[model samples]
Target: MKYYIGLDIGGTTIKCGLVDETGKIIEKDSVKTSIKGEEILQNIETIVSQFKSEKPITAIGVSAPGIVQKDGFMTTGGAIKDFFGINLKEEIEKRTDIKTTVENDANAAAFAEQWKGNAIGFHNYYCMVVGTGIGGGLIINDQIYRGGHGMAGELGMMSVMNVDNDQHLELNSLSFTGATVFGLLNYYNHHSDKPEVTDARVIYELADKKDKLALESLDFFYTALAKGIINLMVALDPEIVLIGGGISANSQFMEGLQAKIADLKSRNSDVRDLTFAEVKPAKLRNDAGIIGAVYRAIQAN
Candidate 1:
């Protein structure tokens, strides 16, 4: 059976897999991304060659943490400085000898979920990712809505305040995730005479203890997230918003987020009838990016 390959590149590592139409990972593996040279492309080639050994794949898909141009080259990836303006498609294909398609990682994940996962029935909604940063994707009538320059639904970059006469308000790209992670870790550090601690997961693990500081940390996260959602509701009016990423896996935060949204809606009449996106776990989980990448590559090819 013919299969497709998907590659998800991150700051420190790369995850790639072979996926069929059934959304199964026929083969999966990871490798360190040696960004110092052209070895990044070599790493991807290695993964592709291994997967192709047993199965005849038709095309390749790349879920990059950058803006994917229509031609499948990368325009910009905020966290990774080297990938900016790089033609990832050509570089990979030159080594692998296969046609490749590229897309923003968050966009690819959202696309995967929309087509095969939780939001299967929704045509108009938003996909919010809450891991390293809050990234967003908009789906309108079953299509990924990339504004003119393939730069739509970048909710993380949305503005939230004005610092000066010339400066308007803006939310930090990864502030929500960082704040949520640090707020809890900082509290735990004060309670214990231990070494430094950092990680969003650490925060969640400690939430059940109901530590005053941990609760407060959660409060801070939900407040900002609520405001962000409100801002989105006011502007996009999407029918539903699916939450993805590692952080969204926690039910405690999800419950708190719901309460905050309810409170915010009660205060505004125009938004009184509005509802938060039907928040739920991304069915594809880590596989969303790979599956979405495969979808993009297939369509492009």
Candidate 2:
């Protein structure tokens, strides 16, 4: 019986797990992510060493927050400054003498869904993670598409709004600014005098209570997100768009987003393309990255 090490590296923590071939996590734990690259690598090595002491590990799979190439070369570290332009696969393999695989965090989540979660058996889909910003992954024809430079799934960078000549206009138009929790908070704090909501859930709660300001903020967010979804549908015509993130857990938000999309399509005949794509919440939740990393390692082996 062979086991693999799965690591999901985030800005705040590094989640490590020992996974079997069938995606079962035998043991899992996490450590704080080090600000320095070398210390982070050491932490991973410690975890791997501990896991190896108990089992016969065959390979490792890492999910990182950045522009990770198929070969595990990170072009830009999303939040970890020290990881920029580093070849994570080579580093880990050299240190552990085990086969290693790496993938972008969002791509890992998408792959996990296709392999064992919501999108199981689906051939074409897009996975969008709405965290502080938006991150996206494409699974087309049953394969992950990383684009030419392994940076294709940057859906957040897409511009959804057009405004007059103002420096703030460009930032406001970005999908990241329009659709994410951080964006919602920014909008709520800047536009309304309702004590400055901190969490996105607070806005949702207020909207549920029929607070006008909260309702308006959510309306703006849903509208922007609906526009982005329509644009994706028009471009790729994917079978489904899986929404991933903490906010996706909100049934009201998902329902509202779907309703808004329907409403937008009905109003604009040109966006008839939206009907071709379905929107649903992702199923894997927090474990998606770990499971997907194991799957990637399995494939590499």
- TM-scores of the models, in the order given: 0.87, 0.92
Which stretch of 10 consecutive residues in model 2 shows the poorest summed lDDT?
173-182
lDDT of 2 at 2: 78
What tens digits encode model 2's per-residue C-alpha lDDT throughout 1-301? Answer: 7799999997678888999998999999999988899999999889999999999999999999889998889898787888998999999989998899999988999999988888987899999887777788899999999899998877777777565566665465545456555567777787886686668888888888998888887887887788888888889999889998778998998999999989988888787543567799999877788888999999988
Model 1 segments beyond 4 Å from truth? Answer: 35-37, 161-194
- Which digits, one per residue and each the tens of the lDDT, describe model 1 over residues 212-258? 65666676667667777788878877778788776667787678888
TM-score of model 2 relative to the true fold?
A: 0.92
TM-score of 1: 0.87
Top candidate (TM-score): 2
Please report how far candidate 1 places residue 103 from its true position, in Å: 0.6
Q: lDDT scores for all predictions?
A: 0.74, 0.85
RMSD of 2: 2.1
